[model samples]
Target chain A: MSNTSAPNKDLPGTILAFIFIGVGCLAWWDTFDMGDSDSYVFPRAVIVTLIVCCLLLIGRNIIWGGGKNHKPLDGSAWRRIGLVLAMLGTALLMPVFGFIIVGMVLFGVLIIIAMFEPWTRKLAIAYPLIGATIVISFYLLFAVLLNVTLPTGSLFD
Target chain B: MENPISYFFMSWSDPYLLLMTAAGTFAGVYVGAIPGLSVTMAVSILISFTFSWDTNEALALMVGVYMGGVYGGSRTAILLNIPCAPSAIATAIDGYPLAKRGEAGTAIGVATVMSFIGGLVGILVLAVAAPLVSEFALMFAPRDYLLLAVIGILLVGSLSGESLAKGVFAGALGVIIGMVGLDPLTAEGRFTFDSITMMGGIHYVTAMIGFFGVAEALAQLHHLETPAIKQKLERITPKWSVVKRYIPLSIRTSFIGVFIGALPGTGGDIAALMAYDHAKRSVKDPSRKFGEGAMEGLVAPESANNAAVGGAYIPMLTLGIPGDAVTAVFIGALYIHGLNPGPMLMIETPHLFWFTVGALMLANVFMLIFGLTGVRLFIKLVECPRAILVPLILILSVVGTYAIQNNVVDVYWMLGFGIFGYFLKIYGYQVGPVILGVILGPLMDVSYRRAIISTRESFGDFMLEMVTNPISALLSAALVFLVVSQTPMYKRWTNKRRSV
Candidate 1:
């Protein structure tokens, strides 16, 4: 019944969050080279604390395997990966194509990635129309009403 | 008290200010209900548009939005797990669970009523004890704020700590993210990697959207086919018994919100989290466990964060110090209006102070009306199919992140954090503490250094000073008490005492 939670998995995604920490650790090592001692003091202290905590978490995972129902990443991993890729592509291209164009395209890409039901004729027509309406509405709301200047791409200019 | 009574009802008496307050409260609900829009962003934007408007009219509108927005954040937190603002982080812990149990209507109802009570209590305190509270807020040493941040982080240390390591690591990593830009004190970069884009620093709003908004969409991929739970909407207003049960707790957390809000740098987010911690500690017979659909969990934070609205104004009116980002914007608003905010403000123009108090009280009444009525429409959002809702949320998150600064780099950071946060979630860790860490990390960093320098940089002297000073000693004792209470030994001892 728990949403967003893979209700049956016990192997809490330690490997993933840990991978992120590993990346953070690399950047933190550069704190040693800063010219001013005042700048690095708090960060260095936090780095030490983080490293210690990471070790403890890793140790706990090894000694006590999580939920008995622990399973490896399954086929849903593909959808998760695709969701990330579609959004990443949209983000990278937004400045080139602009928010109006990229936003409409991203909505279509996401619907296809997330959809499980077989597409019907009505479904085909409605999805794109609704997506465009939502995108345009938000654009007007942010750009006109809120006074935030949304990106206009080189393509549009 | 010296101000004329009519000044207290100025917004109520004026047709223009009354309409502005009502319109502001209405727009605030939708703004706060949306996934990536923030009250700070809203207020900041309003400043640009209101530059030519009457200052009193502008303040009236903003006061309504501030009160309504803080309460509105709970809408998404309850309906979906995403907290639009940091203030509602605690609300989602139990609120989302309540929605899963098909009680979204009841949860929103509880939050709205409790928020009303909390907002009223906050305004009441602002009226009765603004000066006394402002003076107390000033009395806190830098070390005391540092201690408060530490305790805030440690609250995560106690949450489902089946392994305390993950919780602490997540929070510490968030602190590292908060430190990415130039050092506030020394002007040297902490982790910018010599890149110009990195020097601007990452906004916590982006981090907030990533961790709560996009990450939640990623997690929903596994449940696209799961039918939405139809929420029971019969009882929008809580029963008299339910209201009576929570009144005492509501008042306690409202005071907590006011106290934390009165502090110069802290605001509702910290206040709500602290109040949530207090609820967990005090309520021995909760209807359900704290994170598992307990009504108490929803009530405590809702009240505290809303109460913080009144608390945030105290320093601004009394000492000319802005309490947080939104109030800092208010300070700007005050100046544009040609009214100076300081100790002289009360003596010179008591009418303005009383006018604000009245406008805030009016806003609280508006918040209650709007908050309860909007539940009927907002609950439908949670019921939208995952396949459609997921895509909508993802796009909204992207657009909202872009709107923050019109920068693609911030959008990139938002997506990166979203992917990381997705993994953190499926891994069974709560991202609330990480957001808390991001919000409080710099404050802690600045305060610790100031406290240390105040002791002439002698580690021994710093340690000595904590005990020698009354406030520091009290905070130190509280910190120690929290740590001791978290130990398994303490749990076992308490269990035996209860059984006996």
Candidate 2:
């Protein structure tokens, strides 16, 4: 193995600092269009502070070695990506299918994606039943007991 | 004034009231234990349900839930490394590590006992020192508030994982995000970019739920195949010697909690984090290293967050100003009940004050009983398959997000933040400061502008005022000291001095 660290963090740290500087510039520019000093002062002050912090980060990476490994995204990263996608899917589908129905679909899909266990007949039967119980119980608690109006799908309505 | 004694014992006489308080505590424990279900949300929901109930009955239940919920967040933090509320972030730092070492039960026992002690200290202060504290709080000017916000933001140093600069950058990002909505003073759109949703700004709670809950779930997916840690079931309760050793530290941190919690713009979240920081500095001989299952680490934050409950009520009952978010909801609850929580509230409604004190005490006792009894069951939760737990956490986060305003946009925002936060975490940046920034950003914006306005927008005059005013000068000094203490130069100097 090479003596040097596997991944250099300084590169990413410098990149992030640049991004922060860009954000700070945008924030500072926006303040100029404001009608009054009251609206602009705080943002301007914070922007300056932010820009300074970004510069500090850049300087630190230059002064101190950050050749340490940046987190590697492997199979687990893809799984995380899938989990986020599943959540987004549920968000889009929930208003259409109602929370409970979408909730079950979510549970079913999430378990299949997250669990590496082979699709056994027992799990196939058990997962849906348990998912239904959790979703329905939460529905009752929020809608019935607490009187929170759950999102009723237009189709259901 | 009515006798405080008669009011203190008010709940004891009424079985129904006692039952209601117990029920609230029970519900609060589970609600708080669940990731994404925050105490503020629970209390806010309770306000809607208890609208028709009698005033005393509603107060009892709300107080019970408030007290119990703050303590409950530590449960998930210890068992799952996912804090149910922002206040529990500090708890997860050490509590989760303790759980990994199969000491989940012992950590929880310490948290429970310390929380009870902290709760008592807070209530005691509320009972005896509320009037004095209220008077002191009322003296704070806008400039002082800006200073307080600065102090809070600087505490990001504690949350900085590997790099302090990264923490500051994350916090600044949060501040920028917080500034997305309409300017509080000028009513002009800021960073909105003509987007309707941006005009409303981001809700810190949504950001917090996303960062801590959803982000944590996504991160857990990386280790789906890792087997669960088998928790030690025996010797769950701490011995008297162990308890006694930590009592002094608990009392000290509890004082910090009560003091911070009583501040108008701050709450248990800040209190817990600050207390954790204080513990890191003060506890020279920790049982283990701080942030690695140190008994002191768990005790400091757990005690501080609960103590904040009483600290929060000080301003609400006396001055109408909210001490924290939960108290802000409580103010709404009081208003709904046709009572104004202002200067004359205690004088006019003395019984309410006394009853709350009594109720909070009762709730703390209930929390102790409930908290200690759930270790076995909680360990099972810790030992559950990661594959199963990860999905469940995702769904729970969704449900919790949906509960807030019943809007899908909030859920979307939550998921987005979660993905973003996961990346940030992987990059070795901490998310706690970001959430803290979001919470304090608006406060900072409003206060900074107000202070400048108070000085007629003259920059030199504003600087002069900061120095001329005794309180402002003290606060400015504190901020400078905080910065100086964290510098590498200062650290080296201190070490050299100590060596000499």
Candidate 3:
């Protein structure tokens, strides 16, 4: 919420570096009680080195304003986000609805949304049907032929 | 050792083996041409599919995919600026420019020939060097591996665009993400936060799908309205004269590719970039045209990446250290096929080595045939409407990720990281370094830990030991020089010196 755009660019990198440093410090602390001959010796060194490197990178970023001007958010950003969500939703639903059903519906939706081309009747039927067949074949190849277990939705049962 | 001639004859005679090789090559090409789908994924999936099969059959299938996948990436690189795999990134630099200039066919032709030459060189090296290298590689200690992983990470500077800090940061982030799973040395969960699934850590393949495939798809959506590729279909044959002209450069780049590929943890991607950089630096007369669709640019990267495929096998067969992720998975396939790869492998299973060399040689020949005929079809693929093609790619990505472990969790992870990756890419962060981190992180962790434990209680001794070890010392010096050369201070100093 700070209007300090100067600091914002460096914040993400700094936060990441601090997180590493924090973790490294914790690793070092946990092993601090160990004797010099202990196995924790090298891990502690690696952790310490990682902390130093992270701090150096963070320091450099802060000094440089993270290099180059940050571009404004593009308009398609939300649409892209939505497409990702839709893909995730479909993947989650695959086991429940069957890979075939989920794949077909998602393929239809994605093609329509992503391409934004007006659907012809031929494509509307063909695309999903083709997509479904591909998924089903893969399901058979892995689950049946290859003898690997795939998610079989309750709908099939 | 079984006679190399007999093994070659057996491999050539087997009908099923021949069929699998052809099928694998075809599948690898198709998979590699699609943006986001890589040869590594295809080969890994093939491993799972061939898990129940015979050893020779499994090796044959995997080798076919390996050879095909490496060549397949050139298709997308030439047609679109989007590299089908990281190895093809350098290929895209000159290839896309060639396509834009209506020389797509000629570029593909040259790439195909160079790929064949590169593959042949790699196979020859594998056949001859495996025994010698395996003997030498046995001398590697955990400390040596640690230094090698450090060198691998240093490559992040060379691969990352413009900003060294961002590249290192991305790479460090990848290493941290890689650390999210179980700690190899301590057998303790480092970053899993006590969750059952978290204990398993993230799969590199899933990370790859997200980083390369899904993120790439998301990036494509922004440029959706860009005009479809309009390629002028020309004769897809490389003229003998043109081939003769670049033969010297091709062989040079192939050697570059193979040597880099033979080094533990390095792969075609690095080889191709290094080769391209070499070509740029070395070619004085045509250096001005390097990026503007230069033939040398296309030749250097393509030959190197293909040659790298062969180079990658060296470490895999000799030291049991995979040169790249795909070869790492290929090592898994080798194990599944009842072949253990290591120093003793050459002695214990010499026949297997000969068979692999033969298969690779045959696969390269198949690549030439498939590559030449397949060019027109691949170019047509670039013309497919985004509406259809994008959805299909998404589906393949999901299927590919799911096929790895048959886990929906991976799909979710892929999508999660896909979104995260998209944000990272838009912010001008390079994903390649993150991948390098993920791949090299565990190696770095284990070796560093081992080096310390081996050195007893003295951190100074541990440091001294690395500095004193000849190979480690050399690698350290090189890493130091590379980092210094890339630093902003070095650049400023150089600029001031130039102006004065």
Ranking by TM-score: 1, 2, 3
Task: Assess the local accuracy of residue B183 in candidate 3 as a C-alpha lDDT between 0 and 100.
Answer: 64
lDDT of 2 by residue, B306-424 (tens): 99999989998998899988899988998899998888898888898999999999999989999889679878877877656776777778877787677888899999999888877
DockQ of each: 0.60, 0.59, 0.32
Clashes of each: 1, 0, 0
Best by DockQ: 1
RMSD (CA, Å), candidate 2 to true, equals 2.5
- The residue pairs that clash in candidate 2, if any, are none
Order of candidate numbers by DockQ, starting with the best = 1, 2, 3
TM-score, predicted candidate 3 vs. hidden true structure? 0.80
The residue-by-residue lDDT of candidate 3 on A1-157, one tens digit each, is: 3342353455665676677688777666655443442335445555655676677767777775564445564446666867877897887788887777787777777776676556689977777776667667766755675455666676787
Give the Cα error of residue B382 in candidate 1, in Å.
1.1
The complex in candidate 3 yields a DockQ of 0.32
Candidate 3: where is the Cα deviation over 4 Å? A1-66, A70-73, A117-150, B1-24, B27-62, B73-110, B235-246, B260-302, B312-355, B493-500
DockQ, Cα level, model 2: 0.59
Categorize the docking of model 3.
acceptable
Which residue segments of model 2 deviate by more than 4 Å? A1-9, A71-74, A117-119, B335-340, B495-500
